[model samples]
Target: MTTSTGKGSIVVVTGASTGIGASTARALSRHGFHVLAGVRRAGDGDTLRANGIEPVILDITEPTQVQALAARIAADPRPLHALVNNAGIQVNGPVETLPMAQWRRVFDVNLFGHVAITQTLLPALLRSEGRVINISSIGGKLAMPTYGAYAGAKFALEAVSDALRREVSPLGVEVVVIQPGGVRTQMAARGVATANHLAAQMTSDQETRYGGLVQAVNSLMDSGTASGVTSELAARVIVKAVMTPRPRTRYTVGRDAALLIRLARVLPDRALDHLSARSLRSHHPRTPTVGVLSRLRVGVSS
Candidate 1:
């Protein structure tokens, strides 16, 4: 799962406190690269510092911290091999129910933060012809009910990656996207917690419309995580994307992700809608949630 070809080189991985980011930092270290692992807390950074790995305090949303990371890398002697943009937050809510502030927060963490960090480090990457790896999700390809904000940010990330790839590939910098289905990472539990928190804030009428759906989605998320691939495996796929000489523009981490993304590419909108609804319906609340979306259809009966 590793190669020493990266000997003495440098790689940066964001959100390295736990899960895939943490695993990726270790894996790249094994491959002989000095890893700059980005964590939010000093405690987290402390835990991740060892061997070839050095953790940096990096809240990608904060311009100061991001610039600091860039400066640290710029001062280093090793050539930058790659930058893995793995930091993320998941906030699930229906488009009609999600507050604009929450929506912006999602984009800030999931999309804009990556853009800012990439912009900051492009000089080093251009100097080394290094790659940019973005950790996306199957949700980027197909949005589910109550996943409007999360999926919207991911979809935007996908587009940004595309634009970046086209803009930089000719200049020798590669931009790659990793879309994972259900990886057994801590993100699911965090996402469920956030979903419930947002659900609690909904208006009485909004709760009546979305509460059951929210519970169902949470249930499904739990099950998916239970059955998904391990974070170690997901990290290996990302490492593969980094080490491959001429990597694909996109690499999917799990079988579910590969299959679902392929389907999304070929299936019509109505067909995909039916598929997504069927998959989610099985996890619907024991209560009658079937009429939830129907309520949206039923406005003033003028």
Candidate 2:
């Protein structure tokens, strides 16, 4: 795990309490980088500290906390070597029914928050000619049904990462995006739960119209969580991005992600639409006719 340039290097990893973030932090620490693991909760910080990485109490969505973290790092003599923006949340629902609040919350955590942290740390990064690694998603490139909020934020993040890369490269700072497919994580479970909750809140008429779609989305999420690549695999890619002298502008971390990206590039829009429709229909528990017929039968019996 050791890296030629990573020995004693200082790196900050946000959302380090679990999944890819946690794995990346641990991997970097083992590779001889001094990892400052940022966690939202004090208990999470304790967990990181127990693992031998320095824990910083940070909530990327909160500007004060981000500023405090930056100030603390700036006070140290060592220049920051890397900043990994890995904190994000997934919210799933039909765009028409999804709450604007949820969309804002997702963006706050996934896009705006990371942008703030990156801005705050730019000076430190510039001083060391460091790298900014943004953990985006396959959804960022190819939006999926019921993932509008999550995808929107990720899409925005991709654009921001691109702009930042161009702007900071002149200053010797590298900006890269890591797009991972379904990685086995709690996020899948949370997404499924959120889908269910959102579906439950729908009116009867709305449910009649969108229930199958909701079920399909939940099914997809379950499969993703069950079959996704390991977070460790993602962490390996992140470490490579950080340690490589010349890194690509973006890296797809999982096989599925790479395939999706390829498909997005090569497939015609009409073909992709057909594929997406097929996937949804295949995953849906009940066909539209079956659902309608079942409801009619229940109505007649009553």
Candidate 3:
């Protein structure tokens, strides 16, 4: 009940309103750890309240909310054991088309928000010799056609994790990055919806250039999620990272993630391009309903 696994102690999981975060909170609580589940709304918190799970209203992008989380931990009787930075938003648009404002918003929620919370809670994590579990995507290593903002932020997060791990492991804290492939989360649905919304606002020229590609990527997202692992399964990997004595610095959540990470390591840049373009081609429309695959795909030849 006392040492670092948070067993009978405390752990915090953000974005607990649904998906992997919610599943992780539940799994940790079941392991006898007290879980502070972070949600954006009180109703969501109410839905998660249970024996060992306490739901906290947290929007990681908000400074006030982040400080409140730190304060709550400061007052708790149990030592804080881990901070799961699992909250994220998915935004997809080509580099030239995504608005500047949207780009900032993506970084704010995906990258900056995690950094702020980690900085605020470092004292407690260090005190407990706890772990910081960051949920990254396979997109972190493999950037696709329309994932300009999302993947850029994830790539930065991966680098930050490396730097933080080097700085903190010597200080008794562990930073672990979780690379998930297409886990069947609501994120894919939300991402596709957002992508379509942005596509609708594109100029005629932008639409002509990107519209078909966007549609193809959306289809790919849907198929990927349909074939993805469950949130509970993904949570099991996170729990392992939390419970293991000397966990690996990074873990891939599913088979797709593991294979893709391997491919990223070995595949050349041009090879990745052709692989990506071919994958999208299956979902691409025929007869040039919008911009035809031939027009959309530039570098990859038939």
Candidate 4:
């Protein structure tokens, strides 16, 4: 770890290779924070350095990396002001048919990794009276069938955030959950690919039951990718959370995130499920395909 005198508050961002994580690191650096960009690969670190950002080699699931990150931060004369636990993976399929390995892998990075990194850095955060931001999804509140594993981990993260928020408020550390409805990212593309792949693998009867639903959701997602707020926009919101005198415990962003998730909450489970099914059937009106990237490219340009 290269030690530099902190001209501004220090921020550590996990999963800083791409998507929200990478964009957030760049945005925060622009905001004048001494951004410690965290990536699992050294090549990513080199890219960050080329861009004039400090890249810390980190793998949130690895205890040693987390510990090493803590040591590096602890050695810094300046206090660490913020930590963004934005590293996550999306694995979607029929819950009954999904491999246990998929579920475990998601949890390892999405839930437990956040806990481990936060715990390791709690003292520094407390000392600086900083904020910990967890990038969760609206799926944490509304359980989507194929999105079960990812949603489950997010739900657990929400609980963890809520509990820790209360526990640390008095101690000067703030915990914030940024729940996004959707955004144009690799996670979305991967989800579409997973659905299309699984649809191909399943029996005709199984496909008949779940195929259209996946197609509809993918259509909805693909429709929104271009219009959804860019990662840089979302990062600005997060930076505000860190800088604000009083930050909200929960922030739901993106189009219709609040209304849709709230509706899912108030509606009865069976009724919501029915509504979801109907929405899937009618709202999208498109077929699922593994070619999400091309669609996203065209959609972005349009």
Question: Could you say which candidate leads in TM-score?
Answer: 3
Candidate 3's error at 195, in angstroms? 0.4
Q: Provide the lowest-lDDT 10-residue window in model 4.
A: 1-10
Task: Summarize candidate 4's per-residue lDDT along 170-240 as a digit string, tens digits.
Answer: 88888999988767777788777776655556555566566656667767667667567778777777777
What Cα-based lDDT does every candidate model obtain? 0.89, 0.85, 0.90, 0.79
Q: How well is each residue in 1-302 modelled by candidate 2, as lDDT tens digits?
A: 11347675789999999999999999998887889899988898777784438989899988889989988887877668899999988889888888889889989999999999999998889888999999999989888888889999999999999999989898899999999998999878888877776666666777777778878878877887788899999999999999998899999977889998899999998887887788777787755634543554465556
- Candidate 2 lDDT: 0.85
TM-score of each: 0.93, 0.92, 0.94, 0.86
Q: Tell me the tens digit of each residue's lDDT in model 3 across 58-126.
A: 999999999999999999878888899999999999999999999999999999999999999999988
Model 3 spans > 4 angstroms off: 1-5, 287-302
Candidate 1: residue pairs that collide? none
On lDDT, who's better, 2 or 4?
Answer: 2
Order by TM-score, highest first: 3, 1, 2, 4
Error of 4 at 67 (Å): 1.3
Candidate 4 clash pair list: none
TM-score of 1: 0.93
Q: Assess candidate 4 and give its TM-score to the true structure.
A: 0.86
Which clashing pairs does model 3 show?
A: none
Off by over 4 Å in 4: 1-7, 50-52, 203-205, 283-302
Q: What is residue 267's positional error in candidate 4, in angstroms?
A: 2.7
